[model samples]
Target: MFNYLKELSFTRGAWLLLTTSCVALEATALYFQHGMGLNPCVMCIYERLALLAILVAGMIGFLAPRFILTRWIALLLGSYGAVKGLTLAIKHTDYQLNPAPWNQCSPFVEFPETLPLNVWFPSIFEASGNCGKIVWQFWGLSMPQWLIAIFAVYTVLFACLVLSQFKRSSGMRERNLFS
Candidate 1:
């Protein structure tokens, strides 16, 4: 069962689909912020940054799905984003669980000032709310909780994708050497 899933996940079309989904996820987040009037906190903004990284990874994976190096790059980027996201999600989850004094927490993170995205699209990338406000929930799981789960799964999948691609390249190399 796991093997089947691993094989399916490593396919070229699957890689493209995986990366496209990251973009869609980010779009949905923007919708929640803009369309739903839900403000995101600093942790949420950081999560969006991680998601943006994943989105870039997916776009690259989509453009060159069959290339081994592309797969490795995608896996690295995806894993990086997922791991970073997981940490932020965990922090958000803690903040939600244990209400902290706003004075102790920074409302918005300070960027390097060179990052124009936060300035140009403040509505999307900027943090507008304090952490610990559970404005959204589904099946009793808050947004950050869901993010943790999603990022954890993505990390595992990225690892598997890397392993699968490495095996494929090595196998091809062996076949070429003998032939």
Candidate 2:
């Protein structure tokens, strides 16, 4: 199973699946924001950015999955994005579950000066909703809660891919040493 996973990581289909899944998630987020009339908060915006990172990683991997350099880059980016997104989602969930005057999220969204996402794309990146407000829920889970699960899955998959690479490399070294 581990060998299969290692081999799969070098295939285009795996990378395509990763890219397509991220695209679907992004589209769903936009739909929730516009079509469903759900406003995003600052935390949500940060999560979106993290998702974008994963998407870019997937694209890079898909471009050259067989290349070790590209695979490593993709793995690093995906791992970073997954961890960041998971952290943001947990914080967002905390804000919603334990609301207080001093423990609430800020009203304004602050992106880096070099990348003013809100200024460039107000409709998508602008954060006008309060983080403590539970505007939407499904199956008894809030948006942030759902996001936690999503990010967790992404993180686990990335970890597995990384492990597979290490295992494959070690196995190759062992074989070379014996020969």
Candidate 3:
């Protein structure tokens, strides 16, 4: 199983699959925002950015999946995205479930000064909804709750890939020592 995972990390198809999944997720976010009139909050915008990071990482890995350096870079970026997304989802869920005047999310989206996403792409990055409002739910789970699950999956997959990479490297070292 470890050997299979190690080989999978070097395949372009695997990276493509990761990128495609993120694309589908982004499309769904757009559909929810425009088609369904579900305005996004600050936390939602941040979570979207995290997903975008993973998507970019997938693209990088797809470009040079066999290159060890490229794979490492992609792994770092994907891990960052997964962890950040998961954290944001949990906080957002908390905001919705335990609303308080002092514990409310900021009204404005605060992107980095160099990358003012809200200014560059208002339609996609702007935050117009209240974070504590439970405007949508499915089967007793709110939007943030659903996002927590999604990010958790991404995080776990990245963790497995990282471990596989380490296993492959150690195996290579052992083979070289014998050779």
What value of lDDT does candidate 2 attain over all alpha carbons?
Answer: 0.90
User: Better model by TM-score, 1 or 2?
Assistant: 2
Please give each candidate's TM-score. 0.83, 0.92, 0.93
| Model 3: CA > 4 A from native | 169-179
Among these predicted structures, which one has the highest lDDT?
3
Deviating ranges (above 4 Å) for candidate 1: 1-11, 102-105, 168-179
If ranked by lDDT, best first, what sequence of candidates would result?
3, 2, 1
Off by over 4 Å in 2: 169-179
Cα RMSDs of all predictions?
A: 3.7, 3.9, 3.6
- Give every collision pair in model 2: none
Per residue, candidate 3 scores C-alpha lDDT tens digits across 110-165 of 87899998999999999999999999999999989999999999999999999888
